[model samples]
Structures are given as structure tokens and as C-alpha cells.
Target: MPSEWDTHTSVTATGDGLFGAELDPGWVVGGGVNGGYLLGILGRAVAESVPAKPHPLSVSAYYLSASTPGPAQVSTRVLREGGSVATVAAELGQEGVTRITALATYGDLRAMHGDVATTAEEPALPPIEECVPGTMAPEEVRRIAPLMERFDIRFDPACVGWAMGAPSGNGLIQGWFRMADGHDVDPVGLLMVCDALPPVTFDLGLPGWAPTLELTVHVRAVPTPGWLKVSHRTRNVAGGMFEEDCEVWDSAGRLVAQSRQLAMQPRR
Candidate 1:
């Protein structure tokens, strides 16, 4: 079975600097299309436009408006192209209304190297089998957000007490994540996985929709083939807004991707 992401990210070149893709209904969250998925589509256009630099180094997406399931068009404009790196600006639209605008820098990951230092430690997470499935009953999910069914996610038991009516009071969620269809993680897939987890504010007993206003992801390295260990946390929530920081570590213990997003708090 093809992964939902594979199907959705597949785009056809329609014309010069223009591409078309059909957004899958399964990629919806709270009646709006997933921001990361939209970014993946935009990244595809950027990558194809600049074939010399295929890997996304950093992508910054700003959600202009909400989008629904349908055929969307991506228009790309190459901003800069160097021997080692390329930058592109792209937009995603449906029915002639633009929904997302993004600026992305792409390059060959193999040609990049630098002294890497990190004070951040990977969060401890139990084995996938030992963690709690980050999903509701199938029937409930089917009616609410069928998109979630496309991912295999297992959340840290300690941070999931909110689901059991015991709020942890800390905005942190750690988990193991992978495609339900078992697709290997690629650079494009890494973009989607970075935002796959439920909002960190969920553990703080906030529920509903936490719509992302802006999201920026940095692809650190190519991911090894295996489940990704993910950690998402929010340090502050004020004035109906919050910021989430996420880290994606491949099974080989490599930091593959890191992201931060500004999103609205759940409205009750």
C-alpha cells in the first residue's frame, strides 16, 4: 500500500515553474489541510525546479489561508542558485486563492559538513510497543480526523496523562513515529513527520485546534531507515498563542530534523 504522503506529495509538472498535485482528504486536520503536508508539496516544486540541489536544508512556511482537499497548484520562483545551495519561493493555491507561501533553501546534504555541537540531549522514550498509541478509537478518528490514521505513533506514557483526565501540566510530548504504510523516511517525509505529533499544549489540558501560523524546519542530516524518536515541547503559552519546538531523531540516534512553530492555543 502506498503511503498517504507518497500519494499526496506526487506532483506533475503542468508548465514552466508550475506544478499540480491532488491533496488527499486523509491529510486533513480539524477540517483544514495539514501545513507540513502543504510544505512538502511546495518543497517538491522547489526541488524539481532546482534539480542540482535536491535536499531541503531549511524551509520556512507561512500559512496565508486555510485550504481544503482538492487539486492545488504550486508556483515556484528561484531566488538564488549557487554551486552548493539554492533558494526558492513557492506558493500553494486552490481555486485561485493562495493558501501557503514558503521560502526554502535546498542543497546536496553530502556536500555540507561543519563542526556540530549540541547541549540538547535526546528525550528518553520507551520502546514503541511500550508506548501508548497516539490515537483515538478507529471509529472516532474516522469521524473526526481521518488523517491521523495514516501515521503509526506511540506517545510517551508519562505525558499522555491528559487523555486520561490527569493533565501533566507540562507542555511536552515524546513519541516514536512512522508512516502507517511503513514508508522509509526521506527529506520530504521528514517535513511531514516534524509536525505529525499532537500539539504539546494537549498535555496542558488544552484541546481543539492549534492551527500553525508559521513553521520553520531545519533538516540536519539524512535519516536512517527506522522509526523516528520525536520530542515536542512548548515553553510558553500566553495571549492565546504558543510556540512548539520539535526534534526528530532517527533510530541510529542521529538528529535528522528540528522544527519550531507559532500556533494558536485551542479555543474553548
Candidate 2:
């Protein structure tokens, strides 16, 4: 049986350079669909359209309009195809209205080699078993958002105190993440995991839907198999707008993906 994420991201060729995917309501966050999940659909379309089975290197997505649960069409155009890298543009639409536009670069990671260096260190986190699991009651899931049920997230207890009326006063969240159905993390799966966490603003006592205006993700390497260690933080909030930075490290401690997004703060 396919996991919810797999089933939702699956696309079928509908025509030349065109594909279609069904948007599941289970992927919704608030009244709008989750941005990352929507991007996954486009990523699949682009990956299938290209001759080489290249992994996504970088993806920049702009939310042109909001979409509800339904069928979505993807139109992909290969901007450039090089010996090592390919650039593609994709648009996701519903009922002939464009909802999201994306530009992505893809390449074979195994063929690339360089002197890898990074000053950033992965945050120390407890074992997944020791962390506090993010679970909601049945009624709460119905009231807030059902998307939480699709992910297996074990959050740092210290960072989730705000849910109990205890604000941490710092906009930071660290956790272990995996699909509820135990699917392996792939490039498309990494995209969904990048945005799966609760907004960092939740710890700042701002609890409402924070719609992403734009999101950009860079895939550093293909993830190693296992649960992913993730962290999200927000350092700035002004004029009802804020930015969230997310880092996803595979079980082998390699940074698989990193994302940054600008979002509107909840209007209280």
C-alpha cells in the first residue's frame, strides 16, 4: 500500500509534456493545501518528463494563487538540458487557473564530486524514542488540520511548551521526522518534509495559519535511508511577515536539504 504522501505525489501523464495529480484533502493545512506537498507534485512531473532520472538540485516555488482539494494539472518545459544538469520550469493549476509556478535544476548527484566543507553543525537532538511525539486527538485533528496525521513527528518537548500555554519565547523547533506509513525519504519526500513542521511562530504565542508566500529549497545530497533529523527556526518577524529556515539531516548526519520561506504572520 502506498503512503499518503506517495499516493498524493503520484502523477500520470495526461498528454505531451503534461501530467495530472489528484490533490488530497489529507494534505491540506488550513483552508489551503500545503505548499511543499504541492511542490512535490510538480517535482514528480519534472522528474518524469526529463530523460535522465536526475534528482532535484534546487527548487524555487512561488505561490501565485491558493488551491483547494481537487485535480491539478502540471505543464513542464525543459529550459535547458546539459550533459550534467537540466533546468525545468513547471506550473501547477486547477480549473485552468495557475496556482503555483516553479523553476528547478536537476542533476545526477553521484557524478558530482568536490571538496565538501561546511561550517554549520547539526543540532544535537535526543533519540526519536525519547523525544515527545507530535500527536493530536481525533477531535482536535478535525478542528485544526488533518495534515498532522500524515507525518510521524517527534518534537523536542522544550520547544512545544507553547501548545500547553507555555511559550518558549524562542522561535525554534527540533524534531525527528518520517512518513506515517514508513516510506523512505526521497527527493520529493524531502520537499514535503521541509515544510511539514509546525511554524516556528507557534512557540512565540502566535497560533494561526501562516501561509507561505514563497519557498526555496536546495538539495545538497540524496538522503541516506532512515528517519530524518530536522530543525526549524525563525529569527525575524516584522510588519506581519516572518521568515522560517529549515534544515533536514538524514540519519547518517548528512544535510540532505535546506529551505527558507517568507510567510505572513497570523493575523490576530
Q: For model 2, how does the per-residue alpha-carbon lDDT over 145-228 read when each residue is reduced to its tens digit?
A: 778878889988778887787869799988899888888888777877888998889888888889888899999888898889
Q: Assess the local accuracy of residue 126 in candidate 2 as a C-alpha lDDT between 0 and 100.
A: 81
- For candidate 1, the C-alpha RMSD (Å) to the true structure equals 1.5
Q: After superposing candidate 1, which stretches have Cα over 4 Å from the reference?
A: 1-3, 135-138
Worst 10 residues of 2 by lDDT: 136-145
Q: lDDT of candidate 1 vs native?
A: 0.87
- Candidate 2 stretches greater than 4 Å from native: 136-138, 141-143
For 187-208, candidate 1 gives per-residue lDDT tens digits of 8778888788778888889877
Model 2: residue 47 alpha-carbon error in angstroms: 0.5
TM-score of 2: 0.95
TM-scores of the candidates are: 0.95, 0.95
The deviation in Å at residue 72 for candidate 2 is 0.7
How high is the CA lDDT of each candidate model?
A: 0.87, 0.86
What's the C-alpha lDDT at position 54 in model 2?
Answer: 63
